[model samples]
Target: MMLRVTDQTMTMSAQRSLAASQARLAAAQAAASSGQRIGRPSDDPVGAGESLRVRAQIAAASQHQRNIDDGTAWLTTLDSALGSATGFLRQVRDLAVQGGNGSLNQNGRDALATQIDSLRKDLLGAANTRYLGRNIFAGSSDAPAAFTDGAPPTYSGTPGDTVQRRISPEQTVRVDGDGAAVFGTGADSVFGILDAISADLRNGVDPTGRLQALDAAMNRVVAGRVDAGARLSGLQRAGTENMTERNALEQRRSGIEDLDLGKAVLDLQVQQTNYQAALAITAKVLQPSLTDFLR
Candidate 1:
């Protein structure tokens, strides 16, 4: 049997159609105004999840960039200190050569020794260099100075441990150099070597024999500077990579969440037109009066 159609049934159907059309129009207006494809998870659950993931990646990339910057500063400071120490050592080598001269009398030797001692003090200052109130040469040590004041300066840094910074999820870089490795510990330290040479010169003895040791110390400082330079280069590269990754992540997020303003505006206009048409049609269909009901 066919279902009977009544005015009440027709009115209810028209009302439901208009309400659905109004809801679509409201959604289009919201998308246009907000300029986002996914305003809430309910809008597009998969896209929202992807947007969240991309946002998290962007945050991590930002943090990694910060780490790269900090690590660069630390390595730059260390390289500068090592460079200064290398110069000081070179001067010390020259002074040692002058003291080793046979024609140089005791007074001359004493003068050379005094100059060498001054250079040694300068070298010690370089070894104890600090950046941001922390010792660069000291390996994860909280000490104020890397080497203590004494005849033969002692290394105050942690032996095996080093200060490191994580620049990426898979990569970490050591920012601080090993004090003991760069400048030997106890009597074998660069300061100690200088002390021994100074003593030999004051005693009117040849320090040419210790030239090999001085050369070794100079080499160590140079090597440390080279290592710092390498690390700085790596960090610079990582910083660039992190920036690129952030840009890519942002694009991915935009694709997932951001709406095209022009398209959204067009869609809003279309929905508004459709909803108005639906209202007009509904109004015509539901235009029955009480007289018709009485009939």
Candidate 2:
């Protein structure tokens, strides 16, 4: 069978070829300018889904880092207060030792008692410390302070549970310390210990036994500080891990979402050359049409 060749069919074919060349040129130029591979979901469906997932992971990791920062601050504030409390307790122990000496007369003992009393108040102040206007040792309680003033300071903080912060998918940190555990609950607490020493000195009673009580209170404060240090270490470790993971996710997303500028530029040049060639061919082929001869 012989196929008939027609001028109209040739013209239509040339127009279609030119349109395709122009479309390729436009796409290449867009890729060069935007610097992203996934302009639309249809560009690369699998790559687009992966990019979205990685971006969401990055956002979640960022939030985790923020939680770690906040938790670190809370622990730091609590630790500072505990350090001061430890110092005050040590001073109280020294005073108790001086008061315990038999050579010290009642009048001398009274002066030591006064200083111990002052230090006890300072210790109480440290126990009732707040970070960001919330009691750090009060667990979930919204109380301003953990302890109330009294002969034996009372724990007004309802330490229901340890306060926790989420630093990552698999990790959570305890940000609050147990107040009743560190300082004692009521009149039987460290404040009570100091008050007993004061009363004994005024009543001509020897305060030597009170030295042991001071030692016990100092131990509690020291232990609390140790716990805070451990928590701080964990927070730092989690922060480092989060940063590492976030970097990896960003790199993976860049592979899926960002353009290879070198390749895009080369492609754009090739497409431009092809489009120009197509335009030249279309002009040469259409120049000898019947309409041109009539003109």
Candidate 3:
């Protein structure tokens, strides 16, 4: 029997269809096994673009959240160092009050004067607080102290070049407190007040007059600490907000980009079944060719 032209074309068309279906089945099986929607842009251009967008958003939000966390940590360090400095200043003020009493003999006052001197040195040392190898209170200067060593405490750092670190898109906070603003006043520096108080107590001069000035210096330090503490509180709040926001963004991104495990497993089972079925059908279709069909 002679085959018609239409029958020959039909056989070739069916074979191509089976081959194409087999290829699709194999790709679907591979996709299910790997648990990804798009292995290549040609596989699913629309889905691939969406996944890329979600991934980019996730990366950006994660980095922003990290920045907020890092900034909060740095601010926390500043608050701690300021707390320590405040304690040192208050200690010196307490010494001033105790030494002001005239009832103590020269020996007692002399010894009290010595303690006061040591406390002053401690206060100055405390002013040189550093974090990450950079001065926390020394503004731009990394000097041992914010004050001059000789006689009066001199202001060391400039104001304009103060360091400010970016904590967020719209926010930048000062990383280092201005040393001059923190310590030295216009007329007399913190060191000057401490020195004058120490000298007055040692000479049996009018020590009562120094009490007001010493307390003022202590108050200044405490007030500055409170301000820094407030700023730190703001940063902590910002970090928390950023964490929550970033988590939400990541959740959305995951929904858009991450594979659904349950669906992927089910799809894998279906694709595997289909792939096996296709191979069996293809074997039958390609086996014995037109000779088998006649049989």
Number of the predicted model whose lDDT against the real structure is largest: 1
Ranking by lDDT: 1, 2, 3
TM-score of each: 0.90, 0.91, 0.83
Candidates sorted by TM-score, best first: 2, 1, 3
Q: In model 1, what are the clashing residue pairs, if there are any?
A: none
Estimate, for each residue in 99-123, the C-alpha lDDT of model 1 and write its tens digit.
8789989999999999999999999
- Name model 3 segments beyond 4 Å from true: 1-15, 42-47, 140-148, 185-187, 289-295
lDDT per model vs. reference: 0.91, 0.87, 0.70
TM-score of 1: 0.90
Candidate 2 wrongly placed segments (more than 4 Å): 1-8, 288-295
Best candidate, TM-score-wise? 2
Candidate with the larger lDDT of 1 and 3: 1
Alpha-carbon RMSD to native, per candidate: 2.7, 2.4, 3.8
Model 1 residue 198 CA deviation in Å: 2.0
Q: On residues 1-295, what C-alpha lDDT tens digit does candidate 3 reach at each position?
A: 9966664575687677667767766776676667666678887688678778877766765666676666566567767766776776677777767777767777777777788788778777667666777666667776655565667656566665566656566777765676666776444767788788778778876566877877777677777777777877777777787677778877765665557778777766776677677668756755555765785
Q: Candidate 3 local accuracy as lDDT?
A: 0.70
